[model samples]
Every structure is written in structure tokens, then in C-alpha cells.
Target: MNLHPRIAADTLPVCITPDAHVRLMNDNRWPWLLLIPLQEHIEELHDLTHEQRDRFMADVNQVSRVLQRFTQCKSVNVAMLGNVVSQLHCHVVARDDNDPNWPGTVWGFGTAVPYEPGQADELLATVRKSFK
Candidate 1:
């Protein structure tokens, strides 16, 4: 399935799982990942079939663990809000008190800081390796 334009614009492809397309948000302020389900026209979690939902949850759990392990952050935030982008996607964000947003949510907090050259590449490589 094709990704929503907004998601495609804001994220870089990381890896493809059986049920979702994993992408890394471009912002370097935090370690964020997006898991977009491959099912067409799915706007919410309830829209997924039981099997699909199970697979999607597996993807979320795996990605969340990978993000936590890679960043060793204070916490991992997982959310599925479709207010701006209606696509069925999950956000796995690594949060630490030292991060810019800190105690606040990353949404609409500030402009994203793009990853420097090779920075995103290194992260993508690390995350991909963990999935193996």
C-alpha cells in the first residue's frame, strides 16, 4: 500500500515487516519510528482484522523494544493518533528527560530537527540489525 503523503514526506524508510512498513521520522531531536500498516484504506486500529491486528501489535512491540534498546532512553512512547494523518500508523518514540520536549509530548511542540548526514543511516542500520 502507498503511504500517506504527509507520512512519506516526514519519514525515511527503515525496514518492511510482514504487516507494516517501518519508517524513521526525520527529526533527530528524538529517536522516533513510524509503523504504517500495509492494509489499504485502514484509518484506525479497529479497522484491522483480528489476524492483522495481532501482527500489527507484534510490529509495535518489536519496534518499541528496538528503539528502547538502541537509545537506552528513559522511556518509550507508543501512540496511534490519526488527527492530522488519517492513515493507520503507530509512533514509537524514545523519550528522555534530557530531550527538548522532556515532560511534554513531541506533537506540535516545535519544528523538527533533521538528522545530519550519516546520522540517520547509522540508526537505520542499527535498528535493522536488531530485527534480524
Candidate 2:
């Protein structure tokens, strides 16, 4: 299945699991990742079959653990809001009390801060290694 254009534009490829395509959000303010299921035309979680859902959840859990360990943040937030992009995807974000959007959601909280040259590459390498 092809990724939604918006997601493809905003994220960098990370790695793929059995059920989903993992990608890192371009923003550097938070350690955020997206898990997009590999099924076609799936706009909601309920659209996935039982086995697919299970696999997707496993992918989410794995990504969350990786983010938690890598960031050591105060908390990790996960959500699947398809309001803007109708494609089904899960967001796993690492949050800290000192973050700019502390005590609130990251959605539209502020403009994204782009990573410096090679910054995203370094992070992607570290995260990819952790998955192994």
C-alpha cells in the first residue's frame, strides 16, 4: 500500500515491521514516530483484520519501547487521529515535562522545528540499531 502523501512528505523512512511501515517524523522538538499499516485503503483501526490488528499493536508496542529507552522522556504518548489524514496510522511520541507543549497535546501546538543537517540521520541510525 502506498503511504498517504502528507505522511510521506513529513516523515523520513525508518524501518518496516511485519505489519507496518515505521517512519520518523521530521520534527526534532519531540521524538515522534508513525506506524502505518501495510494494508490498502484502510482508514480506521477496525478496518484491519484480527490478525492484522494484533500485529499492528505489537508494532506500536515495539516502537514505544524503543522511543522510551532512547529518549528517556517523562512519558510516552500514543494516538491515532485521522482527522487530517484519513489513512490509518499510529503516532508514538516521547514527551518530557519541560517540552514546549508540556501538559498538552503536540497537535498544532507549534510549528515543527526541522532537524539540523545530519541530525535526523544520526537519530534514524540509533533508532534502527535499537530495533535489532
* Candidate 1 structure, TM-score to reference: 0.96
Estimate the Cα RMSD of every predicted model relative to the unseen true structure: 0.9, 1.2
Clashing pairs in 1: none
For 1-132, candidate 1 gives per-residue lDDT tens digits of 899999999999999878899999999999999999999999999999999999999989988898888888999999999999999999999999999989899999889998888887877997788667
Candidate with top lDDT is 1
Each prediction's total of clashing residue pairs, residues at least 3 apart in sequence or on different chains, is 0, 0
lDDT of 1 at 61: 94
Looking at model 1, residue 129 earns an lDDT score of 81
User: Per-residue CA lDDT of candidate 2, range 5-81, in tens?
Assistant: 99999988999877899998889999999999999999999999999999999989988887888888999999999
Query: Which regions of candidate 2 are displaced past 4 Å?
Result: none
